[model samples]
Target: MKAKLGISPIAWWNDDLPELSDDVSLEECLRQSRSAGFTGIEKGRRFPDDPTVMSSILKMVNVALCGGWFSGTLVNEDIATNKHRIQPMIDLFKAVNAPCIVYGEVGHSIQSDRSRPLATKPVLSDADMKAYARRMTEFGEWCAGQGMPLSYHHHMAAVVQFEHELDTFMKCSGEGIPLLFDAGHLAFAGGDVLRVIDNHHKRINHVHVKDIRGPVIKALDWRTQSFLDAVALGAFTVPGDGSLDFGAIVQKLAGYGYEGWFVVEAEQDPRKNPPLRMAEMGYAELMRVTTKAGYVVEAPTFPWR
Candidate 1:
């Protein structure tokens, strides 16, 4: 099996909670990621929207563009509106040759709202989920036609947070909407990570190798604590440092012939866990696990090199 290691800029600079971010520029983030042995980095707010500018910035560290999140409001919005809103990112990702665009449905999501409790997250009925899934399939198809595929992200504090909700959404949706397998979010929502991969391995186009602190997650009172509260309590960390067994996770993915980017995407306070140190630790753990999985881990190939 073949694979590539990547890291998300959210570890360095969080867009949702700016206070958790490190005081660093876009170039610095890329440099640190590369220094930690990651040859690819995901998009962030500091990244230039212009494709040319973004490419130039990434070239400085010989890092390739992997994937980035798009807050999709397709739960309530129409296809045309979302299509228009996503055109720039589609164009940018296509230009950079990214694997896929991470689609996280943010409509009525309380992930960023500190005042709202986790128990108060939005929920939809079976019929409602079917309708929403149809729309998502349509959107995903359109994105693929535009040369940028959509990988749906089932996040905590969102509509499709739980395992049953994800299963229902997947059953309703078609192959057009591929899944972005996130181990941390699924574990945080009380789902079996291995079970999710076993069920949806067919539709998984992208992967987020996120790890979480089980104790911190279990200590949170869903009725009174928010997702951000859990984050503030150091609920998440990179692999090998936290509770997830990435060795088994990577081995399972390799068994399915999965060859794509395995991105480290732990979002926590940069002050508590220094970004450079965390990046190195994540890269080390991934190297250990991916090597054990028999993956020939590849590095970035710069066109101008």
Candidate 2:
């Protein structure tokens, strides 16, 4: 099946949220995203929190509600707290008619705190994984009732950063909960994107198609800086400008029968590269890569390249 292309509003919100400026309003962001050839957009917290309002705005823009990121501290936080955090987002998804909610580890680590003295160590232990799995099972059941799916986002700096962590999380996660494969984040965290897809293609429910500069990634590693620090330094860029092998990765995802949004999520400075320009470049590259991989390309209604 052909997958739809979408852009994450988080890209604009990075700078837009701090300014609280009129320029980055939800309506404006959606307008720009649609004009930039994106069929859908991922919701950000800065967007309207009220589902009805958010849905109405999206309907007006002719944009679909692609799934979005939600902060979940399942590893360290208590089950009650986690449940409370998850239910509202799930309700929002149902209200907006979004198929899924992308989740990631938040707050504390599941690994030993000593692994990275400066940063929070991953807290995802075997016991913690089991508890998380149970919580996920409950969440999945809740999502099913709402006609939505919960796709866990394995992130860098989070508990499931590296390949081993991903393996553990998958092995311990609830049976039906799907995974959100983010290629750039996986590469930044020192995991092979294609390998991960090859090994666990069955679990992927959605994907975040981000690309990063190879040398920047290496330099960031050499400095041992934080992920946010790297972002501030311009580690990510439009797909073709970066070193990632998207042609191979897209083909792998297709082989697995994956049918979900390919979200362009390059978190960079808008001052350096305006939102519209970045979107244009990224959207074009996405089409090129997907087309090169032998996937049927959909003609975008908005500006592309």
Candidate 3:
């Protein structure tokens, strides 16, 4: 199957840290995305909540709506509470024709924290881990039934960030919960990207393809810097411009027969990197690598029913 290329608006107007590009308009985000050869876009803060409004706006740029992040508080809340929180978004998603919702556990996440470092982020005990897994799996199953598949996102400041946590979650999660394979975050958390793809590709329903600046990562007092602090300093970057091996990663995905959006998402300051230029660079390198891996990059379309 052919792969689709999309880009997130976070590069233009970050939702977590709006101050990053608070002035960049949603119109410019989609326009630059189209200019950069992306056929789809993930949601950002400025994006219209009304599906009709969003669809009409995207039509001008000829970009499809890929998916958007859905913050889940299931670690501290029950499945019902989390489901209620996500249902409204799922309703809007159906109208915009999004394939899935990117589920991120933010109950104890410090991805947006600036005062405290990432090292002091949240941790779940053994029982809490099991409870989270059960709730997420149940919620994910419900989401799929609602035509909005849940693609769980693992981040650097979340309880599910480490290899052991991720493996446990994957082991406990039923078939309803699918992995949102994010190469950059996996690498940022010090995990092997290819190894993760080899293990979880079967359960992957979505993908986020980004690169990291190794020097910046190495220079960081990792225990002291927050995820947002790293972003402010340009820790993440487009694939070819950074140290990540996109060719090997794409080859591995092809081997797994992965089919979905290879969404280019590098959370960098738009003023310095220029979202349009970075998007173009990311798209070009992804195309080159995927093609060499015997994959075709195509226009975006809804995959989940």
Candidate 4:
């Protein structure tokens, strides 16, 4: 099977290192991604938010905008508030021709209405679940009408972190909305990545090919801080170096007939690992895993000029 691979530009943005800025420029990032063998890239917040600018960049590099995460409160808020947060993002994404907006747990707590850890008391009651489902359905329908899909993200520190929470969210959301599966995040949250895909392969629309160091992941608990916090602390990394079984994941995705982009998403501290080297290493690892799993990995075209 022929598969298109990509990388998240966020992999190049590490807050801990100031000297690495030169390496993360748009031109350089695209150059490294292509040289390292990625066919596309997911736009990060550091990229220009304006649709025209973003479109121009993607066109220049011959890389597709795979999609990005929208960190807004969708599950535990009123419909109006949720719409307010998501509508503009959807419009912006539409303008760029991106396929989906990765949906994850909101920052605030749904139960206490106060700022609390995402793994705090789950606020999803039966009524809340139904309402969430209705809201997600509405959002999915809206996105479909606009020619985009809402790919829900199962984050480690979010409300849908654990297996049960993921199960509840998927059950409540029904069949309309698709999911953006992040292998590392699921593993960090104590989920069986292969099993989740096996059960809900149909709902998976995109894949974030990230991996995590088991020791680093086990050192932190969701009850203490958010997943984004862990990301800032360099909790995740590229495949092969971490504990995830990418060979199994690739085989399972292939079995499920998934043909979407496999985006390399390592949100780590670049101070520890330079972004360019990381991208090169990550691409090599991804290629090895894909090839071992009986898939043809395409060589990416370098566009440094």
- In candidate 1, stretches whose alpha carbon ends up further than 4 angstroms from where it belongs are 301-305
Better of 1 and 4 by TM-score: 1
Question: All models: lDDT?
Answer: 0.92, 0.75, 0.86, 0.73
Best by lDDT: 1
For this target, which candidate reaches the highest TM-score against the unseen true structure?
A: 1
Which TM-score value belongs to model 1? 0.98
Runs with alpha carbons beyond 4 Å of true place in candidate 3: 302-305
CA displacement after TM-score superposition, residue 196 of candidate 3 (Å): 0.8
Provide the global lDDT of candidate 2 against the true structure: 0.75
All candidates: TM-score? 0.98, 0.87, 0.96, 0.85
Could you give candidate 4's per-residue lDDT for residues 1-305 as a string of tens digits? Answer: 76778898777764333333445578778878877777778776577877777777776867767777776576656656766777777777778667678876564433223244436745566777677766877777776776777888876545566777777778877667888888887888788889999888988988999989888767766566655556655678898778888888988999878876788988777777777788888888888878777778663333232
Error of 3 at 261 (Å): 0.6
Residue-level lDDT of model 3, residues 172-223, one tens digit each, is 7788899999888888888989888878888998999989998898788867
For residues 130-221, what per-residue lDDT tens digits would candidate 1 score against the true structure? 99999999999999999999999999999999999999999999999999999999999999999899999999988999999999998899
CA shift of 118, model 2, Å: 7.4
Better of 1 and 3 by TM-score: 1
Clashing pairs in 2: 109-122, 109-123, 110-122, 110-123, 110-124, 111-122, 111-123
lDDT minimum window of 10 residues, candidate 3: 296-305
